[model samples]
Target chain A: MDLFGQYVVNGLMLGTVYALVAVGFTLFFGVLDVIKFSHGDVLMVGAFTGFTAASGAAALGFSHPLAQLAATVVFALAGTAALGAAIARWLILPLKSAPRLNILLATLMLGTALRESVRLFYPDGSNPKAFPALLPTSSWQWGQFTLRADSSILVVTGVLVIVGLHLLINRTRLGLAIRAVAQDEETARTMGINYTLIVLVTFALGSSIAAVAGVMNGLYYNEINFGMGLLLGLIGFSAAIIGGLGNLYGAILGGFLFAALQMIGAVAMPFASAYKDVFAFAVVIALMAWKPTGLIPERASDRV
Target chain B: MDAAIEISGLHAAYDKADVLIDVSLTVAPGTITCLLGSNGAGKTTLIRAILGLTPPRAGSVKVFGAEVTGEATHRVIARGVACIPEGRRMFPKLTVAENLRLGAYQEPSEAEIKRRLAEVYDTFPRLAERRNQLAGTMSGGEQAMVSIGRGLMGKPRLLIVDEPSLGLSPLYVKENFRIIEGIRARGITVFLVEQNVHQTLAIADAGYVLSGGRVVAGGTAAELKSNAEFHAAYFG
Candidate 1:
């Protein structure tokens, strides 16, 4: 029973990271109707940004762990948000009238560029970098189960962020404008909502959220690589798809579901646990075939 | 007389195909001006050109005497123009209240938005009752009411209603026209585009008839009502 509880707790922690990444995908898809294939790379860049900020803070003698963490998150979010807005303005908006496939290919190529840049530009970025141990390293033992203090902190932070995001989306006027633009672009324009501004804001918001996930992943694993985003991005996209691509709640649910599947595979499979992704993907493929619209299909009328 | 919207010698196209050619019209402030045409007569295109959704190839479109020929649609809207686009494109998945709130996107204050929202609810009690309901779930007539209420939320100086009567029952059609007339009575200029010649003419101060991408006729609503040319062109 303790073993089961441990797996559940571990799965939930991992799921929170995936959920944050998946939410970005869902938000981008909700507003633009185009998948940003390069979002994973953006998260990688964010992690790198956080790494740089942490190093800079340490060098500047900001010795407090909390200060280092704060600096990392702030720099990562701001940098990634700016990058996202730039990409939307220069790359995505110009291709708005082009063929959908062309835009998809463009974003895919952009992702490759971003990945390569990090690998080539950063000093020895090809090697995995050790992330700072800024989080508390304490652990608690209850009965036969053990809980890490950092893991608990991450889970609480994730819940708070998600709840805050929900309020921002549901209770604010800007949120109302976003929903309007997402529902009908042309009508939104006639209603005095600026399309370009809203699209840029959406991209920034998604990118910043991915940055948070990136930093959290680094802290959780104690290491990050240039290629970490690739796998995480794929899993996040899968989570968004399984949960229902344009549905926010669905994205988070899909993340948890995927994590649970991996956990189950780790325990149930006869082979090594590395085969967990294979098991998860196989189940996702079958589930997708069964219900293409996902667990919570978007309620908007399908575009003709 | 001050014109609310004045278009002179306008030419517009869709890629290679021209949709409006040498079109000229005037909408006087505080009066309903109807643009009458058959299907494919470029009535929608004309509205698009005026709203800057489709930029005119050559012409001037002035709103309240300010030249705004190639401004973006949102900018035009910000300049006090609102549209009840064809099909009443009410963000179907959103609730009626959400749809109405979006109409006042440019409003400055939360209190002002609340005021406008309350005014809309008072104007359409049905919408008030169903404010929390998804817009697409409403009946066709009720949807039309929501669309009009949304336009009113903007407090627009000039409201362009494109086929508010389309797909509605005869009873709803009468109600829609009555509502349009009531809006005009409130001193808001209305640029109405429709194929329902008689009903549109009954409430319009002036009317223009378009055919084959050209304004073939223009006169007072009464003159167009009696003109044999309009009858042969439209009714027949």
Candidate 2:
């Protein structure tokens, strides 16, 4: 029972990370009606940014764990958000009038380039780097299960970040503009909302949240790698699609659902725990076949 | 000092075929000038050209005396041009209030945006009651109120209403026309695009008849009512 409890906690914690990444995909899809395939790589870039910041802080002798966390978040958010805006302006918008497939191909290629660049440029980038222990590491014993405070802090941070994002999208002027652009771009333009400006801001906002997710991921795992974003990006994209690409709640659901599936795969078959990803993916494929539009489909419009 | 919207020798096309050919008209400031046309009469095409959605293949469009031909749609809109498009394109997922607030999107001041929203709600009291309701689920007449209220929120100098009467019941259509007449009464120029000649001409000061992608006739509403060509086209 203790072992079971530990697994549940681990699954929920991982779910938060996936949900964060998935929300970015949903936001990008919502505003522009295009899947930004480079979103995952953007997250990877954010993680690297955080890793670098945390390392610099350690070198500078800022030994406070909370301060280190803050440095990582602020830098990661700034770096990834700028990158996201640049990607939207230069890559996505330029190919917007091109065929839809062009966006997919362009973003996909951009992701590969980002991955390779990190591998080629960053100091010893091909190998994993140890992430700083920037949160309290105290643990509570529950017979066979051990619950760490760091994991709890990570989970709490993820929840707060999501809440902050929710308020930004729902309560703020920028959020209103984002929703208007997503719902009807042409009609939105009629309201004198600058389409390009909103698109840029949306990309930046989504990427910054992804930066938080990347930081959380590195902190949780205590490791970072240049290619870490690839699988995470695939999972995030899948989660977004499963939840309904443009739907916020749907992406969150897909994230948790994906994480749950992985946990279930691992727990259900102890002999082949390493192949749990295969199991989760198989189930995802089946789920797609069953509900192609997603578990919670986008709100339909039948305007005449 | 200048007309609200002036188009001279404007031509627009889709690929090889022309949609609006050599169209020209003037909307004097603070008056209701309507363009009446049937489904394929290029009325919407002219609206698109004026808004720069589909820029004219040839000729110039001046909004309040500024040349806006082929300019970006948002830039044109920012210059105080608001269009109530056909089909009542409400952001389906947003609430009535949210939809209305978007009308004042260009207004930077939160206080001003709130003021405009309150005024719009004043104009459409029913919208005020249903402020929390998603616009997509509202009744057709209610949706029309949202759309018009949205346009008015911008407090535009020139309001281009395209096919406001489309898909509305006679009672609703009459109500919409009444509201439009009220809009012009507020000293704002109105370019009403429509097919309901009788109702439109009732409120219009002057009008033009579009047919087969060209302006077949133009005159005072009374003149258009008595004109032989318009008579055969509509009265018949």
Candidate 3:
């Protein structure tokens, strides 16, 4: 691939990961009007859980890489989903009558606790763990263009995950219930929709998607760390806000835009590439000032 | 026949302050029973008590003679009660068809659901024309139509309408009351909770006046209308 193509490919992968995370944020916000701030830490936990499961699979004599990956991904999804549900059930729901800021603070602290637990307790958890190289490392090359098999797989899987989520949100009864709850919980109840169940399901769904992104991030980078979710979470949240907090399409758009901005920043200044986040965030600030609602603007129903 | 709604010695509270204090009323089967009240009159509380949204702290509530106090809201709704809530809460992002479909959420048979949906569309031909449009994007009058049509889609035994005329012009208010009269004419009981005393008493067979968490008055529509003292305070 040409230099531009390489950047595009790299941005696509990064954007997919960010989009997945942002989708979770948007979904959680849509249903409950609260940000699951610990979402990033949940992603980190999911990655670690997958890592542990992969090792367990190895010890159990499952030598096939694909089988190991499957086990890892499943464990990641199941683990994060449980944690997410617990948070929704025990933490979020109980605090429903409390101020909104309390939920934000509680989730933020929870994120910190998760990060510290992983760092302090995971047996050298503070160090960057080596993520398994399960996918084929072969690359297709033509002239100045090249595409790695693992990258392509990651990209395709991410895209498929997004498509699946879209179908689940738009094509099913569960999706309708979620949207209804989002609009008006009391009204939804009058329609025979269980408000608590939808909230739990939404958190589980969002967390599981984060888990997938966690596993993919590990695979793409060949490394994992306890603090990985911290920056990723902030980036994902920013993406969701830029796209419109309660909008799914906005989340996706925000994710890709954030990624694209980072890519451009890197291209503009190769020697100080670490400052890319600063550049991207600065652009975001400008963008927000220009369009306070979001790039797409929240879908407004006629008021009054 | 069992009263569609029966609430007696009802006491409901938000936190510690009672919203409905010793409230007693009955909504007869197949009749429009208006709960006439101003803001903070506990009318919404009474409706919530029936729907199990706010279960009475001390009361007996029977919907078709089945005790439903403190039951889950959905369960209460499943017993054939539909609420057109205050402010016309629409799943604004959802389409007209989707909103109506949710009203029949417990219906097991898709064919039956479609039949009822068709019936709702038949009643509100405007909703049928704009079935695909997002309900929130519509005019307030049209949104009211969607809300009422949604209530009818459930094929409920009793419909609880909470302030259907909220934020609407006089024309829409008259239009809504006419549609509500149409709903009662279909043999479904209506618990019409409203502040618009004149319009409510016009179509109501019976009504109650709630104030400061108590039943201030209860009478047939004709009696309440003819009572000079009652007319001076509320009918104006």
Task: Summarize candidate 3's per-residue lDDT along A229-263 as a digit string, tens digits.
Answer: 99999999999989888889899999999999999
Candidate 1 vs candidate 3, DockQ winner: 1
Q: Which stretches of candidate 1 lie above 4 Å from their native place?
A: A300-304
Task: Highest lDDT: give the candidate number.
Answer: 3
User: Under CAPRI classification, how is model 2 graded?
Assistant: medium
Collision pairs in model 1: none
- Residues B1-236, candidate 2: write the lDDT tens digits: 99999999999899998888889999999999999988888998899899878888999999999999988888898888888999889998899988988888878888988888888878888999999999999999999999999999888999999999899999999999999999888999999999998899999999999887888889999999989998766555
Task: Pick the winner on TM-score between candidates 1 and 3.
Answer: 1
TM-score of chain A of 3: 0.97
List pairs with backbone clashes in candidate 3.
Answer: A1-A144, A1-A145, A1-A146
lDDT per residue, candidate 2, A1-304, as tens digits? 8889888889989899999999999998888888888888899999999989988888899888778888898899999999999999999998888988889989999999999999999999999999988888899997888899988888888888888888888889888989888888889888888889999999998999888888989988999898888899999999988887888888989999999999999988765788879988998899999999888888753110
Candidate 3 docking band: medium
TM-score of model 2 relative to the true fold? 0.94
**Candidate 3 second chain TM:** 0.96
> Residue B230 CA error for candidate 2 (Å)?
4.5
Best by TM-score: 1
